[model samples]
Target: MERGTRSVVRDRDVCRRHGVVGVLVEPRSQARCAVVVLGGAEGGLHEADAVALAQEGFAALALAYFGSPGVPSSLVDIPLEYVFRALDLLSARGYASGSIGLLGGSRGGELALLVGSHDERVGSVVSVVGSGVVTAGIDYAAGRLDRILATSGAAWTVAGRRLPHLPYVVPPELVRSIERDEPVSLRDAFAALPTGDELEAISIPVERVRGGVLMVSAGDDGSWDCVGLSEVAAGRLRAADHPYPWAHVVLEGVGHTIAGPPGGPVAPYGPGPGVTFRYGGDPVLTADARAETWRRTVGFLRYTLPRETADEA
Candidate 1:
């Protein structure tokens, strides 16, 4: 495929969830054929990843679960059935010749594993900063402090005690929601949802999955247990003795959000807490880390997704 004159298209269409309209991007070149799906956090798609995948010669689609018309950002409100239905839309649309690869980060990563496990049509799967196991509750208080220090380099204090270094965010509200049966606040509602463990319990075996998998973990990420999450998922796959191909990586320095150049166009979703500012956090691929991530992603798709020529082989 010619690298120049890249073709890209962005449009909205109704997803399998009846009234939900999602955004889809189709990359140019007939040589490489793979449909890359972007998973959103609360509900909307991460636009940066979508653009990056498309630029690398893969058709990318981003599904909006919430913040789209009548959709709600609360994860607990969205039904599991609807999420699968959106995946079915990809296969039904003949994206990737009826078999496409899945890629998601954070919460979307957990969802990708679940949907890919349940569906046979997925050709490959990649999860960035995703966990396969769940913690009893999310710790957001440290996250709040980490955010303050990451950007401003300020010291943090809790209960009148000054801390030497930035702590992870484990907000009490988050814990309260996790333990509460009926979420009284929106924050509680989000926290009350199932962790990765719940998703894993319902997930199918990776060995049984038709597509390969590429799992990436941000070791420096303080929001979740990145190392443990990747290990658990990878361990399960290794134990299954499955035929599917899978690779796992734990990047040492970077966090969950990936930028292009040093601060040039960081991953979309706004300036998150505890996010190290590189190149001013462009929300695009501005940092070297995000650029490397894009390169790796493109390479992975070329190798794992269906190929037409032996050159990629």
Candidate 2:
């Protein structure tokens, strides 16, 4: 790891070099917890976020399942086993077993929940603007929501196969066009997308998750209906009477740009320079939500993963 100042040491695609994939961030000193960070369909390594977590005294890995070298060019056909491989690498490098946590944004958020539910070793899960059930990756054409949804392929892969996924379907009236400035009804879109067998096959069983869970959602998400989706995630956990500690945070004015740790720009226009429309929150509100959610995320992980490993405890 190459030392950056005194707080973090960055290993650039150290995983790829070692026949694994993604980047790993480590604290200069010993860390109490380990975290895996994931980004959305836009697909870059969550290196900044992982480094931020490392700065908070946790070992962190920014895992990229797609859109990076040695990984899939898109979210299509990604093996679920990649996540397990990341955990195995962290364990081999001295992060404690079963003390690992997952933090994901957007599509990553959906995955964090799925992985946490499937693996007992995951100590906690933090999702930002995530989906409750499996969702298909829609290739946005200059077409209507319903038209594109019917044609978009599966977003995730498992055991070398694709799992069923919810499509992005909205009635024509509710969604005018993707390129224009028009209001879309996320609720309507989600309601249309959740196919019976598809949702059943891919929905994460929150009751089975082996650790604490935290979900952060924005009420007016432009990218997807994260507010609706987050509520669905929490609702499932509650319906299951989940034994593990869990909570949900709804930011009233914010939208899809709520990724990143505390101390970054508020980003009213979503992420990047080309963000033409409002994601959801105004600058002040989005900024505040970003800081607050990140703080809460760290606290939740600390509560679940202590200085001593779970096995030792």
Q: Write down the worst ten-residue block by lDDT for model 1.
A: 182-191
What would you estimate as the lDDT of candidate 2? 0.75
Show where candidate 1 strays beyond 4 Å.
Answer: 1-6, 14-19, 28-32, 40-42, 96-98, 134-204, 259-286, 308-313
- Highest lDDT against the true fold, candidate: 2
Worst 10 residues of 2 by lDDT: 269-278
TM-score of each: 0.65, 0.86
CA RMSD of each candidate after superposition: 11.4, 3.3
Query: How does model 1 score by TM-score?
Result: 0.65
TM-score of 2: 0.86
lDDT (Cα, tens digit) per residue for candidate 1, span 7-94: 7666564443344456656665543454545453435665556656677767666666554565553333344455555566665555
**lDDT string, candidate 2, 202-283, tens digits:** 6767667778899989876776778776777787889888887899888887756777786765554533212243465677
**How does candidate 1 score on lDDT?**
0.53
Q: After superposition, how far is residue 151 of candidate 1 from its true place, in Å?
A: 29
In candidate 2, position 293 carries an lDDT of: 84
Each model's backbone clash number: 33, 0
